[model samples]
Target: MKILVLAIDRDDDFGVKAGVKGPVIGRDSCLDAAVKLSLADPEDSDANTLFAAIKLYDELKKKGEFDEVEVALITGHPNVGVESDLRLSKQLDEVLKKFPADGVIPVTDGAEDEQIFPIITSKVPIISTRRVVVKQSPGIETTWYIIVRYLKEMMSDPEVSKVVLGIPGLIVLLYGIAKIISIKYPPSAQIVSSTVTGVVMLIVGGYFFSKGFRLKPITSLVRIVSRGLITFIGVVTGFIVMLGGAINVYLTLESIAENMIGGIPTSELIAFLIYLNAFNKYFILGLGIMISGKIIQEYLRRDPHIWYYIASFLMLPAFWKVIDLMTIYSNPLIKKSPETLIAGVLLVLIDLTLSIIISIKLREEVKKWSSASS
Candidate 1:
């Protein structure tokens, strides 16, 4: 039986530190790799792992337990995840091609290196596994060193750092802002600390809730903005216009409430209709502009969804007319006009008919373009 002893460097300490490439086959070559690695980083555990594999190779040769015994060292990329594993797999294939071992004895310095065991076993059965733990001085200093090293690594990882560092940074920022506000307005100073604390807790809770639900509003917005600059600008402008309309309603809210006091049951309903009337025109106009920008963007991209946006844009005027009719009818104070009602109904029907016709025509054009492309 031919047996192969495999020494793994999953993080490519051999290549990165010693400037040696992978699949370092033969007893002599492995020894050379070990010497180079030791010279580069004397305390590297991978160097000890290589020496251990060489020692196992010698022992197996002396026992004559197998017809042939070969020791080889394989190195991976420094990236240490998919990139590292892929390199290890390719190097393993190269080693197997050279010496088709019936079984493999994997020698690893740590659990990270041992992760490649399943990959090796899929190609050849694992006869045994040797884990090389470098001997170190026993003391609190060593324990502290290990803890610090892992903490540093955790902070260096982007995903971990977001939670470990980001939340604290956010808290500090909020606290600073609260202090500035308290100093600027002394009368409200007493409540600032508690308010800041509540705000911090609320923000932190929201962050975790969004993470747990996999909600990525910022990422989605970025993706949309990346698709077209015009679309982004249009959406922002539309939002600003709608916000202005809402602000107007808020500023007039006290007067509207005063008018409703001691009035009929329909007084509140009439006040709501007035607020809607004040906001609907701006809303419809802003929404139409936003949809128009999207239509232009989709048209440029030759996307089929352009027709849907066009239809939506055409219907906005109809929606505005419907809101106007509702406001006029709900308030008894306004004189009812048959001519005004008939005009509003006709306008809605005209908008609907136009939308349907334009959508059908645009869809036919899109179908023709597709047919021509094919």
Candidate 2:
């Protein structure tokens, strides 16, 4: 369970300018050229760090030095604001501790020896890999150089780069399409489209993503199946929630009508009123809980936080509308649908509570699992 963590310095401003950061390579001409430089001669700081790690891993494997080794890319940063190396190192330390592998090695090219060495020494075995020989096969040396040079050229080319990079974007685009289609169709259609799109995405996107996570290659089948499962679960969950909500809404409207014609019960009416008045406040809190769980899940799922933030922000309006609807139905003063309000609140509360509990449980489970597996 010896693991090597390589943090490549792929910080190109194009990623920032293109508004695509975290685990994504940049798209600007300058950024592409920078990536090219890293690939070509290992001139860039980030590229050198990654190259050293890759080379060291290969060398160790060739020599049968680390037969039971696992390698991974490590990108550390703050959820908000710019993160420094110290903060990044702290996060890395925490990750390694949780994993508790035989040893932890960080491969950063230009990190200060003083700053990095102590941090590494404090944790586990630390190998700086400053002058590590990544490739030294006598016969393949020339071929390796030529290949690296060619790959650099390919990465620099707009068309090739687009093909290389656009796979994930395209997969995302197709997923969106499939989701949109599924929502408008039957269960069969939804399952079929989602399965097909998920498979296609896993194939296309997995290739690029694997390259991005070069050190640790995840199987294509695993990626595809996981995505399909998620899609299936999401569709099923949506259907269940919608059907239940509809039934509750109907019942609530009936009760509201009955109360209006008859008389409002004091206890039920008061509860309904309180819910309506605090709908926005409580629903927002509930949504926050739900989203926090989702974020944690995404992190565990290997998705970048930046992307998670963007996606969550985009869905906020829709979530708010749903909240508003539920609140309206539950409002005792505006409507006499106490039953409907109760049902909606209960549904949302249940979901929120479950997500939180599951998240906490998963965290503990993963820590234990990783430690045991390590």
For model 2 the local lDDT of residue 201 reads 63
Q: lDDT of each prediction vs. the true structure?
A: 0.86, 0.51
* Highest lDDT against the true fold, candidate: 1
Least well predicted 10-residue stretch by lDDT in candidate 1:
257-266
Per-model TM-score, in order, reads 0.49, 0.25
Tens-place lDDT digits, model 2, residues 6-97: 44332332233333233322123224434555555453344444445555656766777653454444443332124544544655565565
Query: Candidate 1's residue-wise lDDT over 1-374, tens digit each?
Result: 99999999998999999999998999999999999999999988889989999999999999999999999999999887899999999999999999999999999876577778888988999988987877683233335546866798878998888788888899999999989999999888779989999999998998899899999878988998898978888898888889998888768765654463434335566677777876888898789778878988888888867778888888888999999898768777666779989999999999999989998998888888867867
lDDT of 2 at 7: 45
User: Which sections of candidate 1 miss by over 4 Å?
Assistant: 1-169, 176-202, 205-209, 253-268
**Residue 308, model 2: Cα distance from true site in angstroms:** 88
The TM-score measured for candidate 1 stands at 0.49
Pairs that collide, model 1: none
Residue 10's C-alpha lDDT in candidate 2?
25
